[model samples]
Target: EAEAVLGRVEDVAGLFAETPERSADSPGSDWEDRLRDLAVRAVLGEPEQAAMLARASARELQATLGVDALRVMSGSISYVRRFWAHNLKGAPKASLEAWFEALTEYAVALSYSRRLCTRSVACAVQRERPGSEGRRLAADLAQRGDEESVDYGATCTDAYVAGDRVRSLVNMAGLPNWALHEGDEGAVEAPGPLHGCASICFNKGTVVLPLTDICRPRDFEERMCGRGKPCRGFAPGQLVRSLVSAACHPRALARGLEGRITAVDRTRGRVNVDFGGTNDNGTEGALRVTLLLSDVSPVEEFEAKLQSRREALGGFFVGESVRSLIFLPLQASRPLLFGAEGVVSMLDLQHRRVLVRFGGEEPLQVLLRFQDVCLMDEFEARLQERRGVLAGPLPG
Candidate 1:
C-alpha cells in the first residue's frame, strides 16, 4: 500500500513540475487539464483520486530527499529571505531591487537538495585566478611586508593577483608549508618582525560574504562610541535639516562656511558637521571643522527641534527626562561599515546622548560630550520642555 502511494505522489509531482513547460508551449493549458488527465488514468476516481495523488507525492518526497535534506533546503530558503531583508534595510531602493532578482536565482537553486553541485561549480570558478593560470604570480608582496594579501588569503582561502603579490585564491589553499621561502633565518630579528613567519592555512573552505554587508564590531563601536555609549535622541532627517540650517546661518555664511553633515546622534541630540575652509586661491579646500549642533543652533531652537525632529523621524524613541530622550526617526542613514561612505544618526534615550558617526573604510565611533557643546539660542529651552513630555512619568 505504501509503495503504491509513493508511486502516485511521484506521478503527480512530476506532472506538476512539467506544467510550467507545457503551459509555455500551449497557452491554453491549465491546472484542470492536468488534473483531469491524472483522474482518468487512476483506478480510484474523482476527489479520492486527487487526494491519493497528493498523499503519495508527500510520502515520496519524504522518502527520496529524507528529513535532513528537506530541512536544509527549507533553511536555505529562510536564510536567503533574511539575508536580503536585512540588506534591504540599508541599501538603496534601486540597488535592493536589482539584488532581489540576482538573489532569487541563488535562493531557488539553494531550495533544491542538489545545491552542493552548484556550490562545487562556484568553488571551481576560483581556478580562473592568476597563479592557477599558466604562470605562477611571484610573492613580491610578501617581501614588501604587505599584510592585506596575507589577510585576504587567510580570510577567503583563495586569492590571485598579478604583479607584486603572490596572490591566488586557488594554489594558496593547498601549497605545502615547508615550500615557502624563509627569509631572515638566523639573522637578528627586526623590532616588529616575528621570529617565525605565520603560514596561511587553506584546509577549510572560506565563507565569502561582502565586507560591506557584514556588520563588524567596529560598526557597533562607531554607532555606539567607546564602552557602547549609545547616541541618544538624534534622527537622520533632523540632522540633515540641522546641517542645512547651520550652513545658512548668518555668521557661517559670512565666513563662506557651509556645514557638511557627517553624522547624527538622535539619542544625545548632537550633529557632527564639517566646516569647509578657504584655500590659498580663496576657493574652498577640504572641510576642517566639526561643529557640534549645540554650537550652531540657537539654544531654544536646538532643544525644540530635538522633540519636533523626534516626532518627524520615528523609528525607535527612548528618553529619561521628557526633555532628553533620543527620538529615532523613520528614515535612517546607513550604518558605518567597510566601503560604506555616508552619514549615520545614533540615538540613546537612556543617556540622552546622540552620536554622529563617520569615516574610515572600517567604522569608528567618536563621542561628543554635552559639556563640549556650546549652546546657541533660546530654542534650546523650549526643546527641553518637549523632551520633558517624552521622558515624563506616564499617567495611571
Candidate 2:
C-alpha cells in the first residue's frame, strides 16, 4: 500500500483511517462493515478486503463525482506508471476527490491481475447492450477446467445494475457533485473542481435532486398536460413562465413568475429554476427553489422570436471580460480559478458557445456554453461565497 502512494497521497492503508471505524461485533450492513472488514484484512495481510473496500470507495466516488471520475482516476494512475514520472509536487493532498481517487489507484493496482474492477464497466455494458450483454466477457475470462462455461463475472458485475443503483446513474445528467448529493451530504456540499463534475450556469443557482426524482426533458410530459399545467420539459437555460397558481406554488403568483430553466429533474418530473423577486419579506437574497415541471410554461413564442433576434445579433460583441461561474462559482481561493476572471475571445453562434480566455501564469482558452459564465456587471451579484479554503487565487 505504501508502494502505491503517489507523492502526497495518503497511504491507502492510512487513509482508510479517515473513514468511520466499524465496530467489531456489529458487522452492520452499512458502510461501517466494509470499513471494518478492510481493517481486519489488512492486519491479516490479505489484500482482498482492501480491494473490496477500494471498490466501494470507487463507487461512492463515482456516486459523488460522476462516471467521468473513472477516466481521471485511471489517467492519473497511468501517468505515474509511465517512464518519465514527475516528483508530483504539484499534486495537492487535501481535497476529498483526490483522496478518493488515490484509493481507486490502489484498487486498480491490486486488482490488475485479479480484475476486481470490472463491476462498473460490466454493468455499464450490460445496460447499454442488454440484448447481447456479457458475450465478450464470458469468452475472455473463460476457465479451461470448468464443466460448462460459467458466467461468474457477470453475476457480480450485474448485481448493481438490476436496481435503481445510484452508482450506475452517477452524473448521467451532467449535474455537479452538490447536485448529485441533492445538497444533502455535507461532505460534498460544494462543487470542488471541474474535472469529472462539470457545471451548469450555477449562476442561476440549482436544486439538487435524486435520480429517481427527475425525468429526462424529452420524456413525455406527465403532470402538465393532465391539468393544463405547463407540461413538456424545456431545454436547460431556455426561458419559461409559470402556469401555476399561488396555491400550487406560493412564490409562483398565479402564472406570474418567469425564469430560465437551470436544470430539469426529469426522473420525478420537476424542475430547478434560477428566478428571483419572489421573496416578500426580503430578509435575505433568494436562493434556488423547486417547482413542479407542469407548473411552468416556456416563455412566449414572442420571447422565442426575441431570442432569435438576439441570436441574429449572436450574443457577443468581440471582447468582454466575464467571470466564470463554475467550479467554485463566485470565487475559489484553493482551486486557483473559481470565479476567476476571463475575457471572451470568440463566439460560436451555431452552438451558442463562447470561447473565453482565462489569464494566468500560463494563459488558457476554454470554449463553454453561453450560460456557464456571468457578465462582469452581474458577476458580483451572482457571485457565490468562496467555498473550501480562504486565500488568494495564487499559491505562495
Candidate 3:
C-alpha cells in the first residue's frame, strides 16, 4: 500500500491533488525512472538512514538523500559479486545457478552490516536528528530491475537469449563457464560471454527453473549436495527477537526480547530460547523457554523506530531524564541495566543501544532501548508493585 503514495512528497501542498478515484498503476511518470536496487539497499542502511528505511522507495528520498549518501553503491556491487562466487563454488549449478545467485544476493541485500545492507532512506531529513526523533517521509521507490524477477520470475530465455547481443552483463544468468571471471576488464563484449550457453536450446527444449519448483535431483536441503545444511533457518546459538507481542500475547511471550536459541526441536515444531530470566526456583528467566518456530525472527539489522519507543514518554529527546528497567537476571558476568536514573544522551547506533549518561561521575551506560529503560513518571509504583520486574531481585 505504501507504493500507492509514490509521488506524495512533491504533492506536499496537495493543492492540485487528484481525487480518491485515481488508479495506483498509472500514478506518475516518475515511476519510469529507476535506481540500482543493489546500491539503494547497501549504503542506505547507515544509522539514521537505516532506521528511516522505507521498503517502498519514495522519491522524496531522492530529493533529501544526497549523492554522498549513495556513493558506496558503486563499490558495493563488488561485495555482492564476491559473495556470489564464494557461495556458488561446488554447487551442482547445472540449470538453477541463476536462482542460487539470486538467493545469495537477496540474503546479502538484507545483511545487518551497515556497509552492505540494502535498506533505503525513508524520508528526506538531516543525517541525524539532533533533539529528538520525529516523523519521516515514506514513498514507493522504483521496482528493482531483475531483482524481483530473479527470485520468482526468470525463464530460460531470461538468461541465454541466443543471438541476443546484450550490452550489460549485470543480471544476465549466463552459465558457470560464461560467468564473469577474475581479472576481467573493459566494456563486456556480447557473444563472448554467451559462449556455449546458447547451445543449451537444442537439448530437447530444456527450461531452467527454481529448485523448489523442480521435483527431483534430490530436494535442496540438509547438506544439500553436501552444501551447508540449513537448520530450519534459525541456527543454534544465534540471537533472535520474539515475534510475539507482550500486550497481545501476555501468556505466550514478550516482544522485542533478544534471546539466544539453545536448541531447535523440528520434530515438535518448537525452539528453546534462553532469556536468562528464571524464578528463584527456575522459570522464564532461568530455563530455556520453548516457543513455536514461527514466533521469532532474526535481528540482522537492529534498530527501532518512533513506534518502537514508549508512547507515554511523548518523545525520547536527548538529555531527557530516565531510569533503568527493573533488574532482570542475566548470564553470569553479564552487565545488568537495572539500577539508578540517568539522562538520555544519544543513540549509539553502532551497538544498537541507547547511551544513557547516568548520574555521578560514572560513564554512559548503553542499554537495550526496548527492555532496559523507561520514562521517570511511574518508576516508583512499577518498582513498588513489582509489575515491571523483567529480571532479578536486584543484587544488593
214-308, model 2: which lDDT tens digit per residue?
A: 22232224322222233364656777765533322223233445666655655457666555444686323333445666566667644454445
Q: Note the Cα lDDT for every prediction shown.
A: 0.32, 0.43, 0.39
TM-score for all models, in order of appearance: 0.20, 0.24, 0.19
Error of 2 at 300 (Å): 2.5
Report the error of model 1 at residue 248, Å. Answer: 23
**Candidate with the larger TM-score of 2 and 3:** 2
Which of candidates 1 and 3 reaches a greater TM-score? 1
The predicted structure with the larger lDDT, 1 or 3, is: 3
Cα distance off (Å), candidate 2, residue 4 = 31
Badly placed stretches (over 4 Å) of model 2 are 1-53, 56-233, 247-252, 278-288, 301-396
Whose lDDT is greatest here? 2
lDDT (0-100) at residue 336 of candidate 2?
26
Q: Candidate 3 residues 305-343, lDDT tens each? A: 223443423345456687886453452343445656888
Q: Write the per-residue lDDT of candidate 1 for residues 325-370, one digit (tens) a residue.
A: 2222222343332122223245554564444444545444433333
